[model samples]
Target: MSVEVNNETDYEVDLHDVQKLADSITEAMFIHPETEVSIVFIDEDAMSELHVEWMDLEGPTDVMSFPMDELRPGSETAPSESGILGDIVICPTIAEAQAKAGGHAVHDEILLLTTHGMLHLMGFDHEEPEEKAEMFTLQRRLLEGYTGRPAPKETVE
Candidate 1:
């Protein structure tokens, strides 16, 4: 799996860890022998600008995902053997603040973002309550499964 992560932030969000987490997520899918996702980490300012430009929002967001396929939400869209899945952009500064506010570690928050973005890439959405539940369930499973082996204590702690 090629997790081509482009870090555009000053805050040190471990690119290696992010890549491993992404690879584990792909592994959990099991269907795709190879998968690729581009992860970009940016600062609050850049995120805010992107939010406004792309999403027409005024403030920074923790993360934003741009799925390559146009598959309707709630439908599965597997990557071709080429392995290009989609793209995920993250903001670590906002993530840390959100993590503190949400009472979770920064890593946990980032993992959640990655999972959420991946679900979107796989054609999932939270436009409705049921859909949201389904997506969240999948996200939790991926996160737990990935962190379970790599950093057991930290995963829980």
Candidate 2:
């Protein structure tokens, strides 16, 4: 998979680590090897603008996903087709705050947000109780598999 990570914020982020996480996620999901996805880190202002424009919300959120080809996870026997998966936008400032609140490293929070955004790109939703449980469970599993450590508790609502 082609995972492109772009940092547009002033904060320093481990771009390589984010790319690796994205790769691991796609691999675990059985996405095509040639599939492409972009992960962008933007400032709070940019995130707020996106929040209003896309989601019609008032303030900046932690992450936002804009799916392209609307890909879905595939079975091992049949991986997803090669195409543009989607773009994941993240705000490091918000992530830092959330990290402090959760008592974890900011990088961990960013990774969690990225995982959540990628799942959204792959047609995952958490609006319902069952959907939230399934998505969060898969996200925790994926994160733990990649980091080789237990993922932080899910606090997203």
Candidate 3:
């Protein structure tokens, strides 16, 4: 498996941690060695345009995923052999905003969005309650592994 991370933000993120998380996210999805994924950190303006074009949302969102099923990372694959998982674009500015809203650290929020994007590439969605539960559960599990920390405490209201 191959992973690429490109940062376009002013805030400094832990490159090693992000790289490990990207690898873990790909492994969590059971990707083969032929799989490739990219993580790009962007500013609010660039992120907002992507959100508008892809999901038709009104403004910048935390993360956006672009799946390229035919391009694996690192090695050039024969057109038929590549399993391009996709690209993940994250906005640290938005993540910081959400960290405050969600009562979590900015790093934690960024981790959440990274895993969320990976899940989307793995055919997971949160359009329904049940789907949301399963996806979120998997996301949490993957995150736990990525961070070497306990899973977040889940509460039912």
TM-score of each: 0.83, 0.98, 0.84
lDDT of 1 by residue, 28-139 (tens): 6642545567999988888899889998999989888887743232213653344467888888888788778777788878877877777788777888889877877777
What is candidate 2's lDDT per residue for 1-157, written digit by digit as tens? 9999999988999999999999999999999999999999999999999999998999989999999999899879999998999999999999999889999999999999999999999999999999999999999999999999988766556
The lDDT values for all models are: 0.73, 0.94, 0.75
Specify the highest-lDDT model's number: 2
Candidate 2 off by > 4 Å: none
> Per the 3 Å backbone cut-off, how many clashing residue pairs does candidate 2 have?
0
- The digit string of per-residue lDDT tens for model 3 on 24-118 reads 76655556766778889999999888888888887888888787773322322322244778888989988888777767788887888888887
What ranking emerges by lDDT with the best candidate at the front? 2, 3, 1
Task: Decide which is better by TM-score, 1 or 2.
Answer: 2
Q: Choose the strongest candidate by TM-score.
A: 2
lDDT of 2: 0.94
